[model samples]
Target: MKLVSLNIGKPAELSYKKKTVLSGIKKRPVQTSLYLSNIGFIGDGQADLIHHGGEDKAVCVYALEHYAYWEETFNRPLPPAAFGENVTAAGVLETDVHVGDVFQLGESIVQISQPRQPCFKLAALHHEPKLALLVEETGYTGFYFRVLTEGKVKITSELKRTEIHPAKITISKANTIMNNKNADREDVHMLSQLEELAESWKKPLRIRLQ
Candidate 1:
């Protein structure tokens, strides 16, 4: 799919909260962006600055098809995103991705390091109170990456799948299945499937789920 637009936010607020003691609370949504300043490779935490990969961590340039979308369902403004994403994407599915997959953003190439798991900081911002729990239910929340190659990327740049290892799982299936299953069970079987697929790939595949 073509990259419709590129969006970057700087120094946006992040927070967390819980509505009722028993209910699954919404992750407080706020504006945030991926920083070119602090990024890390696999196993790096977003909070730690020293360990980050510098601009090498391409947290800022995201595919719009997957992470960011226009909410026609709401005349109201979309709630702020709890976890700040560097790239607001459209068609790129997160779970389907794996290490070694190369996402071509114009001339720049980015490698998938790991999934962007949710943190408490997101919930406190919007006052949703239980955001982390809600995100647990919705895997579409987005992720992080390290820039294998760096260059200027802007809105309307096409996102091409250049390389993907066979050992990777498409996050799209997992995310969709999670939405279908009842929320009561704490099932993460999708994660197992992802890991399984990740092991099967010899080389990375460059295909986005249409």
Candidate 2:
């Protein structure tokens, strides 16, 4: 896949539901090269560290392929970084890639860890009450990458897959399963077994199993 754009942002107050809260879901596109680390891009940050900005989810990625559908849905010009992605990608979708898929980005190496768990912050940022649930339901929720090799990654960098995981659990499938109320115990076990999957994801599934 190709990197269409790189985005970054710090925490800022987001107002919604008659309340204001600090959120880091409104990212802006950047044109310069960025230093990628185990935690994230040098300039990137998240307000709620408990649910964001960790080594297992250093880079949030959204596909450019899904933009047309969403733009049509929203009936407006949804631009790059619209989903608060650190990397805007082209030529790949949630169903086409799998957990533990390793890719090289410019001088850095990264690996897919988990599908993005769309939060209320995203819905609030877009002024859509059900947007987060909609994203989860449609399996267009995007995904995250864990940096393996820290280095400078240019905005123009192209991603090349270096390795594929044995489990082959596509992000799309994971999203669908995640939203299912009747999620199978065997399916949950299979998903929990993936070493490349992030603990934030596995923890819930593990609890369900026990």
Candidate 3:
């Protein structure tokens, strides 16, 4: 899998309904290579620390193929980073890769940590309050990566799987279980017990089991 685009941006005021809130969702595509650190790209920023920009979610990746779906719905061509992702990737979809899978990307090493769960930022961006719901219903929610080796990366960076998780819990399965309140208890427990799963993702499932 390779990045079709690389984008980054800082938090800025955004209009949502009648209120203005600071959001880092609007990212601009960049052509130059950027330094990838443990936290994220050097110039990238996340407005909400409580929910974003941690080591386990340093990079947000969305499938380039998803763009076609959105473009068709909107009846317009959308630019890269339209989904606020740091990397617009091609080749691997949520069903193609599993959580904890390690990959050599560009000059850095990274691992899939969790499927991306979003707030209302995306809905607000399009002035469509239910857009986030549509994204979930479509199973187009993206995924995040935790940097293992800090280095440089760019739009041309390709992901070469170096290791695969034995548990084989794909991002599609994670999102399915996560959004399903009636999900099997054993499935929940199994996902929570994964050693490579992010603590943030584990905690919710752990609570549900209780």
lDDT of each: 0.45, 0.90, 0.91
The alpha-carbon lDDT assigned to residue 2 of candidate 3 equals: 75
Better of 1 and 2 by lDDT: 2
TM values, all candidates: 0.56, 0.97, 0.97
What is the lDDT, from 0 to 100, of the residue 44 in candidate 2?
89
**Runs in model 3 lying further than 4 Å from the true structure:** none
Ranking by lDDT: 3, 2, 1
Tell me the tens digit of each residue's lDDT in model 3 across 37-152.
99999999989999989999999999999999999998888877999999888977999899999998899999999999967999998777888999998889999999999999
Q: What is the lDDT of residue 74 in candidate 3?
A: 81
Clashing pairs in 2: none
Off by over 4 Å in 1: 12-57, 60-76, 79-83, 172-210
Each candidate: RMSD to true structure? 9.6, 1.0, 0.9
lDDT of 1 by residue, 16-60 (tens): 332322111222222332222324212223443432225434463
Q: How much lDDT does candidate 1 score?
A: 0.45
